[model samples]
Structures are given as C-alpha cells and as structure tokens.
Target: MNASTAWRVPSPAEIPGLSYDALVEHLRLSKVNVGHYQSVVSALQEELAKRSPTNAYRCTKCGHTEYQVGAIRTARSGWSSFFGVETAQYHAIICAHCKYTEFYQGKVPPGQQALDFLFGS
Candidate 1:
C-alpha cells in the first residue's frame, strides 16, 4: 500500500497550526479508527490466550478437558463500509477433550498490536 493508504503521522510542516480537534477530524475522515483497530487486537489476544496448547478446555457435556484445533472468522457480519476490504480470519486449536470451539474474529497480528501500542493512537 502507498503511504496515504497506510497509517502515518503527519510532519509538523504538514500542518503547522494543527489543533487537537483538527487532528482528530483528519483521522476520522481518513478512516483511521483507533478504537476499531484496538478492538481487533484485543480479540486476537483473548483468542491466543485460550488457544494455547497448554490451556485446557472443559467439555460442557462431559466435564473433561482436552486440547484440540479450531478456526474463527475475523469478519464482522452485516457490517459494510465504503472500502471493500474485509477483516482477516485466524484459526487455532481449542480443546479436544470437550469438543469446545474457540473462535477468534478480527485477526490482528501480534506484531502490529505491539507497534500500535508502543507508538500510536
């Protein structure tokens, strides 16, 4: 993607008199939704924590815990946008013992989250 298509922080020269409100307005217009991005990251983290092989899944039916693999859709259903891009999906393992399913939507990468958390809105 080009610079404009990707996330960027404008240089001071780009907007010498930029105020907080102005900056926020620019972000909104540019489709830079920070909360949305954070939500996706949080979802992925929760999924990762549960899907770790060492994590045990308790079967609702048998009360047994086991390890298994699973998949989750990242796309938000019934959601539309002017941009045609859809969210990515990530699949992992759940518990085999209980037939439990762990689904992770909004598959934001851990590296991306680390960058965002350390550097941005």
Candidate 2:
C-alpha cells in the first residue's frame, strides 16, 4: 500500500493547535474518534498491559507475552447484507518473539462506541 493508504504515526505538527477546543474539534472530526490520539494510545497501553508478561498473557503460537500493538484499524462488512453494511474496529497486536499477529475486537476505544455496539463489541 502507498503511504497515503498505509497507517503511520503522525508527526507533532499534524496535530491541531495546542488548546482544549482544538482537541475537542479534533475528536469531533476524527476517523478514530476518541478525545484525542493520546487517548487512543492510552487505551491501547491499558489493553496491552493485559497482555503483558505480568498478566500471564502469552502468544498462543510462541508462548510469549511480548507483543506490540502495531496499529488501530477498522474493517467493513458486506454492503449488500440483509442487515446492511457494518464496520468493526480492532487493534493489531503482534507477538514480538514470533511475529504472530492477532486482531482483537473492541480492543480500542473505537471511532465511536455506537459503531462497536453495532459491530459486536
């Protein structure tokens, strides 16, 4: 995928002005709606903690708890389905030792809670 389509960590300049209102507006217009990108990171940190070695979460394939959340992404369901189109969000967690990746549903705050509720959180 091209850089435009691929996900990457945003630069500091990419963030809106440093202000509460700017932060609010950022969340309001975000593709992954949480109060801020930092909020999303915070959530991810919490979730990853559950999978940390201290929590006894181990990679099913390699028996390791060392993993990294590569990115937050969304998936779409069939548009022609009887129930209509649907989308779900997830965190891509990969085992550092074995590079085994797993997609956990509802692992992130999601762009919106309603979206997760509708998509099976």
Candidate 3:
C-alpha cells in the first residue's frame, strides 16, 4: 500500500486449504482494494467505443456487422495453483454478434490481481 513497495499477486500454490471467510479476512486486513466494479454493461460500452462505428459490430460467422451490443464473460483468467485460484485482473469480452469474444491483455491494472480460487460465474 505504500509508494515504495510493489504489489505481487500471491500464487495459488502458496495457499492451500484456505477458506472463503479466511480469504476475505486477509484481503480486508491487507487493504487490498479492487478499485472498479467491472460489469457486462461497462465492458460492452468499452468494446463498443473501440469498435468502428460505421462497420458496427460485425458478426464473424455471418459477416454481418449489424447487431445488438452486449458483454459476455467467457472465463476467469489467471494462473492457478493448489493453494488458490487467482482471477484475471481484467475482464474477457465475449461478443454477442457472431459469438466472437476477445481477450485484451493490454488493459490489466497494475497491482490489481486476484488472491483466491473462485469458481462459477
């Protein structure tokens, strides 16, 4: 939490048999703050802005660019270990058009990483 110190995501293998409550407690005590709430709506808006306006969102399968916009969570990205499951620092985008989803590695936040294994959507 200091300017001089760097943040490192703890590998899941390092933490085995950790319970959900314990993980939450550790995060609380460590002052680990995930700054923003990333939702499907937000992700879609972001992707939409980056896409070409004229072309619209093209369907890869049909080659039709016209379609409705939405964000789909394809998966949780990160290295996994016996200790815990780390969530990806950034969101993976799934396209409703043409069912094309893309993961952009460029936008993951610094010092923003997951600490435990999280299953399900």
Candidate 4:
C-alpha cells in the first residue's frame, strides 16, 4: 500500500476488524512515518480497550455482569441530518457472554464533538 492510502486513520467500524499485529505489519510494509503509525496504533488500542469486558455493567438478557462499552454518533434531527452533523451520541453497552447491546444517549460538548467528527479523531 502507498503512503497516501496507508496513512489515513482507521474508522471506528474498521478498527474492530484490525488486529494489532496485522496493523503493525501493514504499517511497516507501507513505510508509514513513526508519528502516523503511533497515532493509528493508539486509535486501535483505544478501540480494543473499549471492547474489553468490565464487571461494571450487568446484561438484562442473560444476567451477565461483564460488558463492554462502545459508542455511536448520529444526526438526530432534520437540520442536523441535512447538514450532515452528528448531533446525537450514544454509549453502547454490550454483554460479553451473549453479545446483547444496549444504547444510552450521551452528551459531549458541541464544539469538541464537531471537531472530532470532522477530523475522525
């Protein structure tokens, strides 16, 4: 892969599909710069942390106490949709045993959220 294609940060959807070893190999093969490689690795690590099971949550379906936290963003209203603004953020709690997911609405500062959405950071 060329630097142009390889240097882009992985999206949330893509992070789940990439293993750390595979990501490192790909970055090495593509000869990505150290800074970019570190950024990608950090993003992947954050995703991995989010998916790791924790004892804080209990699953309503199977009574499992272990769960993982994920997140989602959406355009909630007509204007937001028309402008392609992700006005709604959600916390997704997933059961480790049965994979049952529940979403709870979350609030983030509008300016920071917009910047994150625009930059994919």
Per-residue lDDT of candidate 1, residues 14-42 (tens digit): 44344433444444544556654443434
Worst window of 10 by summed lDDT in candidate 1: 77-86
**Which pairs of residues collide in candidate 4?**
none
lDDT of 1: 0.47
Per-residue lDDT tens digits of candidate 2, residues 11-88? 355433223333333444444744446534443344445444436657989898787875553446544133332355
Candidate 2 residue pairs that clash: 33-111
Model 2: weakest 10-residue lDDT segment is 16-25
Q: What TM-score, to 2 decimals, does candidate 2 have?
A: 0.35
Model with the higher lDDT, candidate 2 or 3: 2
> By TM-score, is 1 or 2 better?
2
Off by over 4 Å in 4: 1-56, 113-121
Stretches of candidate 2 exceeding 4 Å from the true structure = 1-54, 78-86, 107-121
**Candidate 4 local distance difference test against the native:** 0.67
RMSD of 1: 15.6
Better of 2 and 4 by TM-score: 4
3 or 4, greater by lDDT: 4
- Taken over the whole model, the C-alpha lDDT of each candidate is 0.47, 0.51, 0.38, 0.67
Q: For model 4, state the Cα shift of residue 94 in Å.
A: 0.1
**Residue 31 in candidate 2, Cα distance off native in Å:** 23
lDDT tens digits, residue span 1-121, model 4: 3566554666556766876544555445435556655646666666556654453567889998877789988877786676667777888988889999988666656896577557653
Clashes of each: 6, 1, 5, 0
